[model samples]
Target: MKKIVIPFTIIALLAACAAQPTAESTESTEPTYEAHKQASWLLGRWENKSDQGNLSEVWEKKNDSIYIGASYFEIGGDTVFSESIELIEKEGVLNYVVTIADAGQGPTAFKLTKSSDSELVFENPKHDFPQKITYNHKGDSVIAVISGKQQGKPHQETFAMKKVN
Candidate 1:
């Protein structure tokens, strides 16, 4: 009777272990293509002319898993500020990467925290400034908002741009 009971207990433990979910089964199975599709609407050229300067952003789909973009601010036909951007999907996670031209620093990566058909939010809490970035797309316009702590104080900036092409 003791031997029979021990065998039954071992069998029960083995069954319980088999029933538990594995990490691979629990992780997201979403494909990179599907993730990129969610952001396909951002493709095209966007421009904003303000008293401050003329800002332009252009995006292009590089492949099924990547989108390339660039933004620049021009004053009197000279580019004053510019940055290169890459939206990539890897391992079912989306990342927004930006490199400021001539900043003498490597690119910064922001992970996608919220996403919808018309709005996307990326955040990097460890970043010094603009820890949160959001893009809201309307019919023919897009509004980009960046907010975070600047110099130990809260700060935010908004850019309203219209699709030009």
Candidate 2:
């Protein structure tokens, strides 16, 4: 009887150990937004100075799914252009929205068309000039490219910016 009881107790102990939960097993299975994770890398201040204008872009993460940024373009010490920007994850899709202070229209939104570890592209074919925009991050610098058809002709602008903060 003692031998049989010992064997049964050992079996019960093994079963209890098997039933215990593990750290990985208890982890949530909910899906995480990959775009938000990718966008987190853009948070910081970037600036560029050139003969045409001095441009600066500052980005900050507002929350888990939203990033806010602002861009300023100054020519000859005068503010030529400024815009408020937002990167939002809505319904699992990423949108880059720009609200130009002088555009005299509603915010323009560009949808994410392509993205990688160090690059992102947004496009809005229905918008006027600059229907496509791209940002390529390399080390401590970023190259911003905006291109599209303007006046029935192709036009593109590129800015090489370095991280300032």
Candidate 3:
């Protein structure tokens, strides 16, 4: 009886080892998503500050593809400059078409590459503005640096922002 039990245990262990998956079989090509109920990425307020010490913007998105932003300046002790057109982000690019009553210098197209959670290469060719924005999550700060030339002249500006509730 003892001899039979030892042999049976060895056989069971060998069978279990054989049943394990190999490296190739364990790997899957399928994409997976986890539902994040605690992190409300789209339900917060965001803003940016200008290096000139007189300009800034406040932005928010409600529902799907409905983004609204406002520009605030300290021209004379805090003034509201203008609000931006509604926008949407898909894939890795942000697309915002021109809309009536926007505070831009003109009817501008807003496009930004959402590189990461805290970085974007924002451009408004219609307004002839181009810049890169970098953000720090812990500090809730976004730094904006303009690039390229405007109307045949170099365009440059730096801005920062803090996340608000």
Candidate 4:
């Protein structure tokens, strides 16, 4: 009877330990949409006019996990460039994807490397040009910067835009 009681007690202890929730399990249960909520401020229309061209970008929240954006550049009332962008959160990872149909290349995806209330940085080191892209949000303006190697030389571009709508 003593042996049987000892075995039963050990089994009960083991079962109790197994039933407890672990730190990793609890962390995995956290809502992924919470991370995406941080980017909600980007939902709007932004425009910039300069000697280079007139640039316009429109961002919209498609759902909890996806944000859609369209960017276009116009010169002399003619659209010279345009691209579609998507910010998607998948399995807790955020990706910035850009597609330019006339570029003759598939969409490029940049992983979110840094983020804050007023800034977001995405990077794709393997890309030929523009390995890093950053967006800094001010009260009613956003400054976007792209930097990388172009033709074996360091290159950077900045677009300072204000919220239009």
Candidate 5:
């Protein structure tokens, strides 16, 4: 009886230990701040369909809750326009606020209308851009289609980007 009791206690202790998980083992499935920054397609350089040339944006972290990036457009070997994007998130929703620094336009704020693993859309009635920028994954490249308005007419620009360190 003593031998049986001792074995049963040992088995119960082992079972309890197996049922418990360590802190590292219970890690979150969601992306961290660094991962979120990396997951975004806006992190790298892009080109317009026209002669706007390569637009590179460097992302800077603002505290623990915000990210800021700037973009400049060039044409004919000269800088034509420049802009800044401020992105923030709370409760899984991303807010994109764009400022046309060089164009002298006020800031426009947009909300995340739709999103997926490969695509995200930011739309605001007051903003110019409506349709979401679709990022489709190719073999080794990402195709970004930015659809919006240019002089009250609908227009779309496709940009292909390769992730570089």
Candidate 6:
């Protein structure tokens, strides 16, 4: 009886091991993007210190197709500049819109050029200053990059921002 039991236990353990997935089967499939899924990561406050002032942005979800953000800069105990931003899905594509307080122009729209789990890139070739805007999330920090042609010369600015609770 003991001899039979030992052999049965070994066979059962071998069967279980064989049933486990191999490395190839465990590989993840490519992720599909839903408009709201990517925007949800931005639903928080972010801040950074710069020579221009204390820059901050607050973002919130409005609906499945829209997310709103407000950005401002403070200098010498006063709010010097402000802008309203929005991420909206249009015609099956995502767009980033920026409306400044007194820019004397309509909102500028940047199309979504690239996106991933931790990064988003938008671009607008006709915009006067920034033609490309990118955001990359790494751990607890986000690096925001703005680059384009200024006066026919290339210019770029990077902001290292930390998320606020």
Best by lDDT: 1
**Total residue pair clashes for candidate 5:** 0
Candidate 6 residues lying further than 4 Å off, grouped into runs, are 1-33, 50-52
Instruction: Rank by lDDT, highest first.
Output: 1, 2, 4, 6, 5, 3
lDDT of 1 by residue, 1-165 (tens): 999999999999999999999998999975647667888889999999998899999999888889999999999999999999999898878899999999999999999999999998999999998899999999999999999999999999999999998
Instruction: Write down the RMSD of candidate 1 (Cα, Å).
Output: 6.0
Write candidate 2's Cα lDDT for 1-165 as tens digits.
998999999999999999999999999966577897987778999999988899999999998788999999999999999999999998789999999998898999999999998999999999988999999998889999999999999999998999998
User: Which pairs clash (backbone N, Cα, C closer than 3 Å) in model 4?
Assistant: none
| TM-score ranking of the models | 1, 4, 2, 6, 5, 3
Question: In model 2, what lDDT does residue 16 have?
Answer: 98
Ranked by TM-score, the better of candidates 3 and 4 is 4
Candidate 3 wrong stretches, greater than 4 Å: 1-56, 78-80, 90-93, 97-106, 124-127, 131-138
Off by over 4 Å in 5: 1-52, 129-132, 137-140, 149-153
CA-only RMSD, every prediction: 6.0, 7.8, 11.6, 4.1, 9.1, 12.8
- For model 3 the TM-score comes to 0.51
Of the two candidates 2 and 4, the one with more favorable lDDT, higher being better, is: 2
Candidate 3's residue-wise lDDT over 1-165, tens digit each?
Answer: 999999999999999999999998899944321111111242355564455446655556554445565555665565645445445555434655444344434555657544454444455554544433222344565564656666777866655557666
lDDT of 1: 0.93
TM-score of each candidate structure, all chains considered together: 0.81, 0.79, 0.51, 0.80, 0.58, 0.76
Please tell me which model should have the higher lDDT, number 2 or number 5. Answer: 2
Question: How large an RMSD does model 5 have?
Answer: 9.1
The 10-residue segment of model 4 with minimum total lDDT is 26-35
Cα lDDT of model 5 by residue, 20-92, tens digit:
9989889986535542443465554444445547654455666444778776766666766678887777666
In candidate 3, which residue pairs get closer than 3 Å at backbone N, Cα or C atoms, i.e. clash? 49-160
